[model samples]
Target: MRRRRGFVQFAILHLLKEESMHGYQIMKELEERSNGTYSASAGTVYPALQELMEQQLIELDTSSDKKVYSINENGVKHLQNKHLEGDFWVEWKERMMWRNSEQSIQLRGAVDRWEKEFRKAMKHARGNPESVHELIAFIDDMTESLSKKSTKQGDRS
Candidate 1:
């Protein structure tokens, strides 16, 4: 679960949405918030900042020596469109715990219990194999419903 996808972009935008910060401060905040899971180097973060500026999503305050970066109107609109950040942070925390072997035992226990319950439900749910089309549709619906419920639960946490 060591996800290293568009996380750099999300982390940068997620922090800039809160308040203006310089490049070094942004890096530190990302590291602290992610518990060092995303301790990206300047080589990783600076280019994204530059790209955001190029896209006119962020503005640089050169009045001070720090060169603070503040999200502009366009950035706000972008974050609103992309939903800033939520689920990614939750998954990142879970991954960290699993990696450190801290809460993984608990997580495994919960998942195992859930699987047992789900199989029990499936036993009653499974009907004649002659209804293959209905079975497929039912499975699809269950997947969508479970995914949405899990997403809502994640957001709540």
Candidate 2:
């Protein structure tokens, strides 16, 4: 998904405004806030935190083994000036609401199970052209079947 430049930074600042958090906590909080749509990685979050520190928008407490980050007064002013509370959050919530549904939860579980099995099968099929071809054909057929079912459902709707 393409994102606007500095969006990660903006999100980091928004999160820090609420409370101090470690890197992992920031990643998890971003994921949770976006309803699993935006999964923040350490690579992304840590660098953004470093940039925020450089800009003096946030501060890091290294008193403990784990570095905790908190938004400073400048960060609050930045958010206020930019008006962080806006349609971005409303659109994000609307877009990701499906992920919070019971049906979506079950579908996610099934997809995860399928992915695990697919990975195992791929590992076993490595270097075997015939096995790989069969797997591709099976996946193609499954995708076509699902597409047709979806089309039929749309017609009903």
Top lDDT model: 2
**Clash totals in order:** 0, 0
Candidate RMSDs in order: 9.3, 8.6
lDDT of 2 by residue, 38-142 (tens): 777877888888888999999999999999999999999998888644566555565457666788899979988998999999999999999999999999999
Off by over 4 Å in 2: 1-5, 84-88, 91-157
lDDT by residue (33-145, candidate 1, tens digit) is 77875566898889889888998989999999889999999988887787534576676655654655747767777878977876766675677564556656877998999
Quantify all predictions' global Cα lDDT against the true fold: 0.77, 0.83
In model 2, pairs of residues that clash are none
